[model samples]
Target: MSLEKLPPLLALVCLAVPGTALAVKPGGTLYIKAKNTHLKASSSPTADTLVVLQPGKEVTYDSREGKTPWYKVTVPVDKKGPVQGFVYQANLSVSPPSLEVTSKSPDKPLSPEAFASSGAAVKALGPGAIAYGKTLSRPDSVQQLIALESLAASIDTAQVAEYARAGGLPEVVGRPQVARRSPAKKKGGK
Candidate 1:
């Protein structure tokens, strides 16, 4: 009201002005990476959802300054004014969701034939099937069974193919000689 009060009031206004100006940094862009993402009232997940942000909609948000970091975002409503809330940083990304580069498999899935058992497999079962082949009486048979199991594990498809070729055995079910698929011919060209 008076000149003395005016200086104090002006000093208070000057101190308050810079803090308010620096508080809200109003412009930055980010995209929602997942569907069903919520703009929450706080950083907590249980906080009320202000809006259901769709996958591709653009949103404007302010950068927050506090111990618990959150993005204070604004999303446009249909006819009403924009809704404002915070969103967790995890659900947001700089770019729209693209197909993520996945770690490639070193090889194709193993065929069932890869672990197919040979004659050794049958003998491995013999010791476990009968009571006469107990440990005290038939240690050799038990050892033989363990040996058979080891042999069975080592017997892969390539080994079977080699055995079949050497023993003059008939071709196994999986290995069939079929013609390779040829590319389709174009209508006007070869």
Candidate 2:
């Protein structure tokens, strides 16, 4: 066809296309139903506390920022009763897949008391505390505590290990070893 005819055809096609010329804004409203009464949303998935809600409750939210680009939601406690409100995020799934914790070598002996003590400490102190203690504790317990904390961090080591085995953390491989490098060589190199 001639260029003149092609221009008219192109213009018609552009007009017919929906939301093509006008870019759709990044934001949109979302409505969610509470799958579990205990479910709540947070500003962050890693938040220490959660906002609680009753089952089948609904909430609306918008994005905090484009980067985090998720709706923030809070469930009011006692829909018609007296209770404080709790917060949650939209599009965040409360349920995570299960994971299994297994040792590298099953035959290797483990200290139940030490493991128990470390676990208790981990529970009481949380992930940050356990990570700090891992540095100060003996090598054996440090390894054990790191493993335990990994389980606490997600579902279990088996799950996290899958990511690690898939080559997720190349940056962290030499982290501990870098510290143990010769002080003289380290200073000179730097």
Estimate every model's Cα lDDT from 0 to 1. 0.54, 0.39
Maximum-TM-score candidate: 1
Question: What TM-score does candidate 2 reach?
Answer: 0.24
Candidate 2, residues 88-123, lDDT tens digits: the string is 343233332222232533454333323333343244
Q: How do all models score by TM-score?
A: 0.36, 0.24
Error of 1 at 175 (Å): 50
**Candidate 1's residue-wise lDDT over 1-190, tens digit each?**
4668888898899787754543324676666644445666666544555555545556676776365647777777458677667766655656555432222322443222221222222334553454566646665776677777888877754466557657765323112222121122112544
Off by over 4 Å in 2: 1-29, 33-42, 53-55, 79-190
| CA RMSD of all predictions | 27.3, 22.0
Deviation from native of the Cα of residue 54 in model 2, angstroms: 6.2
